[model samples]
Structure formats: C-alpha cells, structure tokens
Target: MNAKSSHPSHNLPSRRTLFTAWLVLMALTVGTMLAGHVTSTRSLGLLWTGGLLLISWAKARTILQVYLNLRAAPRGWQTGFNITLIMLLLLLLGLYAINALGLIPR
Candidate 1:
C-alpha cells in the first residue's frame, strides 16, 4: 500500500456510493409508507410502517457491509450494530403489536 493508503481507517466507500445508497433507501422507505394508501385498514397502515422500518434497517446493513466494508468491523462495532438492528426490529414489531391490540391509532 502507498504511504497515504497505509491506514485502514482511511478506506471507505466513495461519497457518491454512499449518497446513491441513501437515495435508494429513501425511495424504498417512501414507497413502503405509500403502501398504506392502497388499503383502508389501520392494521395495514401499521404493517406498512413496520415494513418500512425493517427495509430501512436492511438497506443500512447492506450499505455498511458491502459499500463500507464493515463486514470486517471490529468485534465491538459488530456487536453494537447487531444490537441496534435487533432493537429496531423489536421496536417495529412492538409498534405493530400495539396497533394490532388497539392500544394505539394506526
């Protein structure tokens, strides 16, 4: 490696790749939210919201692992990311459950 490329921390996806992924994620999230408009049920609306959250999580993970080369992340970082992913999933599920139980509005 060259002198300037000696540091692993300096290696990362280009700004263009990051921005492109962000745009794609935003589009998918909006599409997921718009899915509710096709249906009249509150449960469907909640499901759409949860789906969007999960899709966003997946897209973020993909960008991290592939574009950002985070597949080789440090153990701590990997663990923390996994925890955050799980928490997001739990939150999404809880939202759906609450709506399903009639404990919250759609």
Candidate 2:
C-alpha cells in the first residue's frame, strides 16, 4: 500500500504528475480561447456556451483536486469543494446567458 507523505506539510505531486496536470491545463486554456473564436447562431451559441462552461468547470476542478492536493483529502471535503465550484460556474453561466439574450439593460 502507498504510505502517506513523511512530512505532513509536503504535499506536492510527483514531477511527472505535475507535468501531466500542466499539459491538461494548457489544453484546457487553448480550448477556451478557441471556443471564443467559433462563430455561432443564437441557438448554437447556447450549446457553445454550455460546452465552454463545462470545459471551464473541468479545468477548475482539476486545478483544485490535483494542483491543490485536495485529491488526497476526505470524500466530504472533495464533494464540498466540487459543489462550490459547480455553483460558481452555474451562476456565472446564468449571468452570461442573461447578458447574451439582452434580457437586462446594458
């Protein structure tokens, strides 16, 4: 069985693991930038927005769980953090949808 880190405060991921995370993070960053460049109709815009939100959620969750060393934490803690991330993303998406639809004053 894998043992815990000898030093309680030393929680850095392995070099290879960190490099993998960096690659994934970079891919997500490029995906987000490309998403903004894609032209779309109003209906397609909603789908595009949803896809962007999902991708952003994935990147943020990965950063929190991997880079922040939250992956080794308890299930409850992980769930809480993930829920918080989802809620934040949902709120942001909702505001964006409203703005895109011109439902409120500019």
Candidate 3:
C-alpha cells in the first residue's frame, strides 16, 4: 500500500474537497428546510433539524479524522471538543423541552 498521505484512499483537504463538501452540505440542508416549509408539517421541521445536525456532524468528523488527520490529536483538543459539543446539545435540548412544556413564549 502507498504511504498514508500519498494514498488515494486518503481524504486530506486540498481546498477543493473542503469547498465541495461545504457546498453539498449546505445545499442538502437548505433543500430539507424548504421541503419542510412547503409541506406545512411541523414534524418536517424536526426532521430537517435532526437530519441537518447529523449530516453536519458527520461531515465535520470526517474532515477532522480523514482530512486533518486529527485522530491522533492532543487529548485536550479531543476532550474540549466533546465537552463543547455536549454543552451545546444540552442547551438545545433544554430550549426544546421548555418550548414543549409551554414554559416559554415562543
């Protein structure tokens, strides 16, 4: 097998890959949101949000693990990233729960 960096299987960044991935993700997210609006279904909003979040996260993780090759990143970076992600998720959940319970006027 070729060396890691030189391997065709590698997904390292070269500007083009990053730009294309970003465009595709944005397009997909926008399309989902538009479809949700057109359908007039509240569940569609939830679906759009959940799907976009999942796809966005997967793209970021791939960029980090394959492109940046940060699987071997410093432990502190990994821990910090996870903690930040967790906190953000918790905040979103709290907001959603509050809205669902009608505790907040939305």
Give the winner by TM-score: 2 or 3.
2
Q: Predictions ranked by lDDT, top down?
A: 2, 1, 3
Separate clash counts for every candidate: 0, 0, 0
lDDT of 1 at 15: 77
The Cα error of candidate 2 at residue 56, in Å, is 1.2
Higher lDDT: candidate 1 or 3?
1
- Summing lDDT over every window of 10 consecutive residues in candidate 3, give the lowest-scoring window: 43-52
TM-score of 2: 0.74
Please write out the lDDT profile of model 2 over residues 1-106, one tens digit for every residue.
3365564236667889888999999999888867755554334466678778898998998898788888777789999999998999889889888877879986
Candidate 2: where is the Cα deviation over 4 Å?
Answer: 1-11, 38-44, 99-106
Using TM-score as the yardstick, the better of models 1 and 2 is 2
Error of 1 at 19 (Å): 4.6
| Residues 2-103, model 1: lDDT tens digits | 876666556676778777777887787677657645455554656666676677677777667656667556778866886888697888678678767789
- Which ranges in model 1 have alpha carbons more than 4 Å from their true place? 1-6, 36-46, 59-72, 102-106
User: For each candidate, C-alpha RMSD in Å?
Assistant: 5.0, 4.7, 7.0
What local lDDT score does residue 69 receive in model 1, on the 0 to 100 scale?
68
lDDT per prediction?
0.70, 0.81, 0.60
Candidate 2's C-alpha lDDT?
0.81
